[model samples]
Target chain A: MKRTVPLVITFIVGLVLIAAMFIPHWPFTGLDSKFSIFYDVIAVFAFILGGGNLLKVHLSRIQNRRRDWKYSIVTVSGFFLMLGAGLLKIGVPGGWTGDYQADGSLLKYLYDATFQPLQATMFSLLAFFVASASYRAFRAKTKEATILLLAAFVILLRPTPLGYYLTFWLPKPLQFLHIPNLSTWIMSVPNMAGQRAIMIGIALGIVSASLRLILGIERSYLGTEGKD
Target chain B: MAEEEKLTIIERLGAVDRRYVFLLIAIAVIIPLVLHYATSIPTSEIVQSLFDKIESLPGGSRILISFDYGPSTVPENQPMANAVTRHALEKSHRIYLMALWPTGSRQSQQLIDEIIKVEFPDKVYGVDWIHLGYKAGNQGLINTLLSDFKGMYTTDMSGKPIDSFPMMKDIRTLRDFDLIIGLGSGFPGTKEWIQFAGDPGDIPVGGGTTAVMAPLLYPYYPKQMVGFMGGLQGAAEYEYALVKKYPKYAKRSRIASTTMGPQVTAHLVIVAFIILGNITYLLERRRKRKYR
Candidate 1:
């Protein structure tokens, strides 16, 4: 009964939503959106579950004196600090009625001082890593590698002023040889063709997988396998 | 004999320390940034289509802009948001702001502070523009809004009922908007908007995204999407178009174009390193053949 009941519910709901897409009338017209709202309401509760789970795991680590438990202290403390600031609307004007992210609020200050800069710093590291990796990996050792390398040269250089100067000497007749023009053609044609084919393939895969789930053949999501 | 002694200069360069490459890249970025170097930006057809769509719209046409990215993408996405917001307001279009990510609310607030509040102080809130704020549920949220926009969002970002906002009177669902632009970094972003809101509602969808995500969006151009801006370069091109149409903006600080000098310099440095690496590879192969 445990698995059967849930599967039955899923089949009913899935079929209704699928029918909603095609029917678009009366009770079935907005059923998908109604279901979406139900999902959102449930998701809001799931956030509470997720937050509690995070605290539990980290607190357990600290209690057990586990490896790198010290880092958990930072996570746990930061989480609480943000939660308190946001919930209480600390430093926000008009007390509890004010916006949580009002200019003078503690949550606003923390986001600006800690969150924003930390996020930017993490993303900025990608530039250095990309440079180091490209230097080491962009060698033309094979025909495929050479083709990739040449394409990379054009795309990478296309946006730069140096690329413009490099091919500016070409006559108007051969202007298609210009780096920017050539890169655009590559992106709009070859790259787009590849992307479209991949997207179509993914769409078909999703349709099949969704159908399987709707038909009760895909039970892995229910945390059981094989016979279940 | 020392093993290093037998290697040619080119071979040695192929084996050059990555630290040097990092240092050179750092210098390349820092120097241009310090100098405030600027360059002429060329607009692409894809980016121009978005700009044109916004420009062609009549006054009071509602344009919804969703901030579907977080702080990490501020450098790439922020300028796109600002440029579009500025352009839309300049044309007297009504603006509707919303977010898919939690951090997006803060990002939108930044745009409000930096662009709308400061530049277009005469633009009245609730009448000219409104922020619906961040909501959870990702693509599900979009789907919910498609059928019942008001059902999903009862209040503005500041907690006032959206019904009180004059600008929102005509905006019953996704189809009401003249345009929808998603400034996003990843999933539940531009792609989700294209699928759930744009295609289903038959609304024009466009966006700006990080460079790494740009390739994925190209296939949608001129069809599923009106057009889009990709990365910092894309933002710079849009900014150039903005300035070209309205010369008054030329005097203001353009973030993307200013940042391009460093970005371009770094690209050149990486290109030089790649060339050096390839030269070293070819040289080593020749040496091996000669020894054989």
Candidate 2:
């Protein structure tokens, strides 16, 4: 009964939503929006579950003195500090009714001082890694690799002034050979074609998957080991 | 040590430690930034189309700009958001701000405080512009918005009822907006808007995205999307276009254009490394054949 009930529910909801897409009537017209709101409300509760799970796992790791457990201290402390600062409205200008992230609030300060800078620092580190990786990976071993290498050079230089200066001496008739022009052609033609093809395939996959789920054939998502 | 000494220069170059490469890149990026170096970046047609759309819009044309990015992408996405907002306001467009990601709400507030309130002091809140804040649903939020805006957003970010705002009076659904600009770095962003709202409602969508995610969006341009700014480069191009059109903004701090100097230097450094690596590879290959 437990398994059947969920399967029956999924089938009904899925079919109803699908019907709602085309019907556009009283019952079906706004059904999607209603379901969306329900999903969002449920998601809020799910966030609480997620937060509890995060604390449980991290606290257990610290308590058990697991490997590299010190990192858990940072994680747990950051979580609690931000939570307390926000919920308690610490240092808020308008007091209890004040915006949690209003100026002069502890939450806003934490976000600006610690959160923003840390996020920027982490993202900026990608440049160094990209530099190192390109040197080692961008090799011209085969004909395709050589073609790829040339394309990479053109794209890498396209946004810079050097891309303009490099082909400046070329005749007016051959201006299409310019790095910027060539880069645009490459992206618009071959790159876009490939992307479109992949998107079509993905759409097809989504349709098939939806059918499976709607028909209750996709029971693996129910954590039933995909069994009947 | 003795065996290492016997290796040729090409072999040594090929095997150079990655740490040295990282140091060179850092030096390349820092030199331009510290020197306040600047340059002219030619605006591309894709970026120009977005600028033109805003330019061509009549005064009080409702434009919905969604901030779907977060703090990590502030450097890339923020400039695009700021530039688009400034352009929209300059044309007297009624702006509606919302967010898909949770952090996006803060990002929107930052834009409002730093750019809107500071620069366009005459622009009234809840009339000229309003922030609907971030909603929990991803694509589902968009799906709902396609049919109803008030269904998802009952109040503005500050808790004032959305119906109380003059701008919210005419905005019944996503279709009410003349244009939709989605600034996002990843999923549930520009793509979701295109799929769930723009395409279905036939609304013109345009926005900026990170360079890495730009290619995925090209197929939708000029059709599903009006036009889009790809990345830091796209942002720079848009900034340049803005300066060319409005000379008053020429002296203002154009973050994207200024950052281009460092971007150019870093790209050159990467290009140089590629050349060096390839040259060493060819030399080593020739030597191997000769010895064989």
Candidate 3:
């Protein structure tokens, strides 16, 4: 009964939402939006629990002096500092009435000064990683691999002035076969077709998985046996 | 000498430390950035289509610019955002900025504070541009905005009422806008816009996404999206077009083009390394064959 009740509720709600998309009747017309608001409301309350859990876990790690607990100290401090600054409206030039995102506020200051730059710094590491990964992995062992290598070479050259120069001397009839032009064709035609194919497969998979869930066949998600 | 000869090119390459390769790439990036190199990147049609879309739009046509990315993507997406906003503002299009990602709102505000306020001070707020900030429901926000934008954005980014903004007066729905462009790095971004609003409302849409996200969005081009700018390269190309057409702004900020020098150099370094790695691989294979 413990699992059965929840499954029933899930089936009913899920079916209703699915039906709502196409029906557009009295209850169904705005049900998707109404449920979205319901989700937002629930999410707001869930955030408090989420925030509390974050604080608890990080604080415990710091207290116990676990491995890399020092990083937790930074995380806990940043969390509370931003929260307090935002909630108390601390150091906001517009005082209590203004937007929490107002300039001269501690929250905004920290976000701009620390968060923005730090995020950019983390992302910039991708350049090094991509270079290292490509050096080690981009080998041409097979016909397919050779094609891939050639494509990569063309794509790499396409964005640079070097690409323009490489094939610039070609005759007018062969102008469209230039590296830059080939790059465009590769992205728009083959790339688009591949993406679309993947998207279609994903859509079909979702439908199948969703149906399984609806029928209670996807019981793995429920954390216990469906028969139980 | 025979022992040295026995060492295959692959063995020699294997002995070469990875740090040297990293140092070479580092030099490649730094040199191009420090020294200005004249690089004429011919505008691709995809980029030109986006340029033409803005160019043809009648002045005062509402153009909604959605800042759908956060700080992690700022380097890639921000320059494109700058170029797009600059072009739209240059064309005298009324701007309405919004965001799907929570941090996207802040990123959008950065553009306004940095570019809009400083460069185009003559452009009045409310009348010229308004920021709807962010709404939480991702696709649901688009769903609501399709029918009634007022349902979601009752106020501007600040604590000001939307009614006060002259630009907000007529924007009852997404359909009312002349064009909607999304600049994002991931899900709930251009894909969401393409599916939810653009397809349903038949509104012209465009995207400026990170290169990683660009390939995924191509199916929508010319049909769902009029055009798109892909990553820093796209940003650079658009910047080139903008500057070339309006030579007056050639001296103004050009971040993408500046970054492209490093971009091109880095690509070359990677390509060279790949070739070197392959040579080692082939030599090793050949040596194994001879032994067999």
Against the native chain B, what TM-score does each candidate's chain B reach? 0.96, 0.96, 0.95
DockQ of each candidate, alpha-carbon based: 0.78, 0.72, 0.60
DockQ value of candidate 3? 0.60
Candidate 2 chain A weakest ten by summed lDDT: A219-228
Q: After aligning candidate 2 to the native by TM-score, how far in Å is the CA of B25 from where it should be?
A: 0.9
Worst 10 residues of 2 chain B by lDDT: B1-10
Comparison by DockQ, 2 against 3, better one: 2
Backbone clash total for model 3 is 0
CA lDDT, every prediction? 0.90, 0.88, 0.84
Provide i-RMS per model in Å.
1.2, 1.3, 1.9
Task: Report the lDDT of model 1 for residue A178.
Answer: 93
The prediction achieving the highest lDDT against the true structure is: 1
lDDT of predicted model 3: 0.84
| Native-interface RMSD of candidate 3 | 1.9
Give the higher-TM-score candidate: 2 or 3.
2
Candidate 1: residue pairs that collide: none
Q: Distance from true position, residue B59, model 1, in Å?
A: 0.8
lDDT of 2 at B246: 89
Fnat, one value per model: 0.79, 0.66, 0.57
Give a tens-digit lDDT track for model 2, residues A1-228: 757888898887788788887887878766766887777667677778988999999999999999989999999999999999988999998788767688999999999999888988999899899999788888999999998889889989997788889997788798789888888888888888989999999999999999999898887877855345
Q: Is candidate 2 or candidate 3 better by lDDT?
A: 2
Error of model 2, residue B110, in angstroms: 1.4
